[model samples]
Target: MPVNLADQLKQQALAQGFAVAGVASTSAGGRMPLRTAALERWLAAGYQADMAWMNNPKRLAVQQLLPGVRSLLAVGLNYYVDQQQGVGVARIARYGWGRDYHRLIEQRLKRLGRWLELQQPDSRWRVCVDTAPLLDKAWAEEAGIGWIGKNGNLISQSHGSWLLLGHLLTTCELTPDAPAIPLCGSCNDCLPACPTGAIAEPFVVDSRRCIAFHSIENRDDTLPLPLHGWVAGCDLCQEVCPWNKHHAKASTDPELQPRNWILQSKPQELKEWDDNQWDEALRSSALRRIKPQMWRRNLGCL
Candidate 1:
């Protein structure tokens, strides 16, 4: 059983629901041949707003997150569905339209890790989704899953931007994939499409102006006036991308489908909900992090 097990592990990942998987090593200071200047420029412009976690230089660097980490195995799961657009109901970002990706991706990674263990008992492994200190998107780009587009989301030639990135660091020295080529080319559609102009440049994103940021991480009882009517996370950028026009819809996972009422909720309707009602509607949703008051703040904006 002295095989290069990364290949088998990746196949298992695809079989387990991941659409794309690749491996790289971890060390410190983010991915080597750093993309720090672009990051620094974005942060210095005060684009991160209250999400101060992005300011941590170490968090911006992969090497610091896992010292002596030799490889990073990156995975992308497609979350798009056929009914991407509809009538009367507010749209949820395809990624969040299902069960929380953190739990979903972790569950699959754990299974894949166990499979790897059976293949190479001596290999050491660690799995990470969004919450980890490591920058999952950067590693995904390095691992060749896709290239980061102008809107700062990884866009695949085949899968477009509706991807959830996950990370796995292992001690084994598997062959790494060449970084994915930038398929975005000269497209600047995301720049003009953003209601708030969050995409400052081809590869830089000003999170402070991002509706997804205001709706998810920025938890103030009221969103800044600049971001209103943002119902949930924003998808204008993704909606306009040519590559996503014919994007494939993934098999549905029950937990990810929105509650009937949630899909049908209106701005005024959600604003009238009491705290208890809010809890019932978003009970197990990633939106729970926004809190009832914050939900009210979002609805009031609409």
Candidate 2:
């Protein structure tokens, strides 16, 4: 059972539009204690806010996601766009400024998975996108695609943290890459940059006080004060990260570019948008996750 498909698979992933790709050997139990424990503590403290899916036991072990998984082919797509948005416009997070990222990354990953399957017909494979139970950040770090930044984002030295990640787990073995080494020795700029102090500590985010959570995920009638002009998602932490500030580049993919409507949107205009208008504007964009009520609620706060 000699296999040397890692190099070729990585090349295929790149050709499929992934910014970076790498492979990592999977642990049999697929449990990382630090991550599991941190999650437990976060949940126990009610830091997950209303996101009840975070309580899933499967999140602690990727083995539950895909039994007999042997190796993870991790891929990242850079989605950064260096466009100037109106200062008065209600802010949409960088990821939602364009087309839905889940669709973008999943389509590319499914192609990679097919390539992997063709090489090893006997291989069992599962594709994991953002909504999957797999720990994408940890696996991507283990694969050396990037290190998990203090802001809880996968930070690639070459591409910063503005990346959408996906994973393909297969029973087939591939040469594993070395784990990435974090370079944020003492830098803590992202900690205080949060308008709502969502970064509880280095890598832990408290969703309760997070503006992004309140804006997009929270369903309550009232949200915490001082949304800081964000109507959909917040990027303050990433904006302040030195790695992102200095090394981040505009994504070459035109699909990831910000929509003209979003760039010129005003709070008043968004608040006035009817459900039909909202649907038409957000048809293919990830920002559609924000319901009409949520949009008006967030806009009201702004």
Candidate 3:
């Protein structure tokens, strides 16, 4: 008997270190309109901050990303590690505590894309990580991998919101999974727990007030005083969520483990390091995304 393509792909994704996998059709129906409307509102409210690319039309429609797209293979990698926080060290988000996930996830996506091409030789595929304009969380939920939580992160009953997401868009027709239903019933822990109050409402995050945005993406020399202590990204919202507290599991992939320096170095220690040392310490690490100058700027606030 011939193997089921979707089943084989799901098994392959698990072999590639993905914790969850699901398929979604590219056809615009169901919740796509509502998701687009929410995005438009978010953009209009200036909640995206300097991320003007959030307005890209390609994000509103999967077909815009790859013409003739028929199905999307969504995969989530668990990057959560149960590590103790250093007493006075600046914090790095769990996702950035290890190797750059874009590199890690994209490599797996490309491999999966190649396998998919072999299964359907005539089909075309595009692998997308964070580099693309696609709404990853929306698609992840649509693909049945998880539900989008009040803090705007995709939450899985088994893996929580500590997932690094990636997708492979292909022209081949595949069975689509039913969308995941919202599971955050009456829980509003993440909203009040956010240090900067970025979660303005359920399922809405105001990036202008987001500590993670300032720590990682904001290029300004100074961050707002309230957004201190976060050297790379913020995990407060995820940390406070009941789902994460109960369901988050430590990742098994060695590539996702935190480097010793990232886990131990204090902000003062990081500030004293020279540029060359910074490069050496954070090489191939996601923390490298926050340039040394930004590190100094973030440290200044602390």
> Among these predicted structures, which one has the highest TM-score?
3
Per-residue error at 198 for model 1, in Å? 1.6
Candidate number with the higher TM-score (1 or 2): 2
RMSD of candidate 2 to true structure, Å: 1.5
Model 2 TM-score on a 0 to 1 scale: 0.96
Best by lDDT: 3
Query: Please, what are the lDDT tens digits per residue for candidate 2 over residues 65-178?
Result: 888888889999899987978878888889898889898888888888888888899998888987987677988888998998898888999888988999998888888988
As for TM-score, the candidate ahead, 2 or 3, is 3
* Cα TM-score of candidate 1: 0.91
For every model shown, what is its TM-score relative to the native structure? 0.91, 0.96, 0.97
The Cα error of candidate 1 at residue 49, in Å, is 1.2
lDDT of each: 0.74, 0.86, 0.88
